[model samples]
Target: MIKKLAIDDLRPGMEVVQMSSSLWEHLPNLYTQPGPIKSEAHLKLMREQGYQHAFVEVEVPGEPLEKRLDAILADRMKDAPIKERVPFDKEIEVADRAYKSAMNHAHRLINDAKMGRKVDFEGTVETVDGIVNSAVRNPDTLLCLSKLAQYDDYTYGHCINVSAIAVVFGEFLGLSRDELTRLGVAGMMHDLGKTAVPERIINKRARLSSAEFEEIKRHPQYGYDILKRQGDVPEDVLEAVRDHHEKFNGKGYPANRHRSDTSALARIISLADVYDALTSDRSYKDAILPNKALAIMYGMRDQAFDPLEVQLFIKCLGIFPSGSLVKLSTGFYGVVYESNPNLPLMPKIKIILDQDLRPIPSELVDLAARQAVGDENLEILECADPTDYRINLKPYLTRTR
Candidate 1:
């Protein structure tokens, strides 16, 4: 049986089935590959590397690794903060203005970097401040708005989205106001190195050749160099820009630093960066829905992402985040207006179409309450693509709750 055992409990001759967490991937000197535990030295090394548990093949009876990990993740989700739900109407207005301002600043920063000109640090700070303040007031508002991806000017929109997401995630983690601002700035500039890459490579629609891929990977270092030359950027912000692509397993590009060596801000921005990139529509591929994106990320935990951060993000957004279109067992279609982390499967939805698929006046429905009242038919059936249903999600996304 495969069982999760504390590093201290590991004994000589016990076979290591696999590393429970991908965080150990970078330390080849400690664990070259999963195999029999040699001695107490191995256990001590793992502890020094910050590993608390490992999956081992033992004669002792136990549950599967997957089931154990799922239980641990569920328990962690419970610890996530449950804030009072603010009315979307009050938050959306501030979010809209903050989003536009951040987008405008991002565009200018990218253009300036491309032209080899110095970035306007003060202006960048102001843009990030607006985003931080808005997130502090009502994270769901900006978070919901950030999901409306635009394809034409993806770079600007993506930066703004990442910044907004990073701030919200940081706030959810109980970061101080100053820390939130720094995280927002880091997210805004995380991809600044892409400006130095040729436009042809940046806009390529086909699969990139090996050489092209290597060239693209250099952006992190290029971004670091560019920012360092400017002389005023904070070290944490620079670290995030340089190492945002670094994975938990130390397999990421540029420096290939392990999770232990990477800064917290870089780790947070990395998750936000991948989330936005996967969910946003691009010329190369159609956008995946938010829930699908989250699932994909969940599978990458301990490998491409920190396991805790991945779970926290899922808790923050729930299974179906705001702006997702879902069908109900009652034969109605609605857009998710907000999530109830405690009841991820049953979020607050805005019903826009009736059973026959005809347009109807929008109405708010709390599936959690419906389920509590014994309305079995009110459960969410599945998430539906807005395009497939001929639904314009933009209207519902912008409408006040």
Candidate 2:
């Protein structure tokens, strides 16, 4: 009998054959590989498991006819971990530095406004520009840091998240490095007016009363006033920060600016802000998954969002982003780990369970190329929310290299 092993149980010198998820349990013998398959075999096993799949310790043969499999394994053992090259820690350090610097100026301005003291708008602009330049010069560093949601204060965290997201979007839009930096600054300062609002309304855990909501709407004007006094911010950035909420249908507040009145960057910032807000957990509402949030935003395109910009956002992030849950055609649940830019719709995934939600040994799957021919039914079925299945993504999302 071929002893059944979970996906992680796979190791060096293990002989195995590829089988569909359904067949893995019922007909173990149906899939069999000759003994002691090395490195290429491990890669094959991962593909056989699913698109862009992975497992532990299986060494299949390499391409280009290596001299010895043992030598290759020895070489790999000497190589550094992937995370080391990615430098996540360094990225976090940079983001923390930027955040701390920006927050100091922001909070001080808030305090001044609260005390009825004149605001130092130039100082705030300078702080925002400093952070934006740091991110634009080293985009990947900030992107790595974006994975952290819980830092000191939720407000400051939100600000950093919004800035990171805007930079990502700006990159996708093909903005130049300098342009991305400016746009990022605009994103960081987008909510500057919120400082003028009372903490009671800003941090309210419950639904806001109508009057409170009305008060909340005035933050845009407050932000505009602060920016206007400073005189350093570009017109487009100021407009985006102040009028992001305005809609095409003229139902938005403050001035109810229409689509025709809003600038392109303002529209993009608005869309990014709303998308991030919906996907993030908040005081009064549970977080929605990115896929569902995208769907909701798609539904609102043309009314609240620019239809073209929404489509571009979708293109930038893919159908299911990294850290999303999905269901495969073979009736298995998996988490998307990385998306191949060359094949956006098909990403590398790690299988976690079967159709009934029972835990199974994890496997890696790459949807772009099927592991075995005539296995069309094993293709991806659809995207799913982990929340719908009560699956927590934190562990997988935080998995180290």
What 10-residue stretch in candidate 1 is worst by lDDT?
A: 60-69
TM-score list, all predictions: 0.78, 0.62
Evaluated with TM-score, which candidate comes out highest? 1
Candidate 1 C-alpha lDDT tens digits along 1-401 = 24446676778888776443344465444342578888888777777877766555556235422234445445556655567645776777777888887877888899989999887654676678888877877787777787864435888888888888889887877665666777888899888999889899989888899999999999998999998887657677788899999999999988789988887778889889999999887777888988999999999999999888798888887798887888888889998887777788988889988887787888888888888999867878889887776767767667653
TM-score of 1: 0.78
Top-scoring candidate (lDDT): 1
Q: How many backbone clashes does candidate 1 have?
A: 1
Error of 2 at 137 (Å): 9.8
What C-alpha RMSD separates each model from the true structure?
A: 15.9, 22.5
Query: Which lDDT tens digits does candidate 2 get at residues 94-180?
Result: 555666676665566556656655654434444555555554444334433443334565566566567666776666554544455
C-alpha lDDT score of every prediction, in listed order: 0.79, 0.61
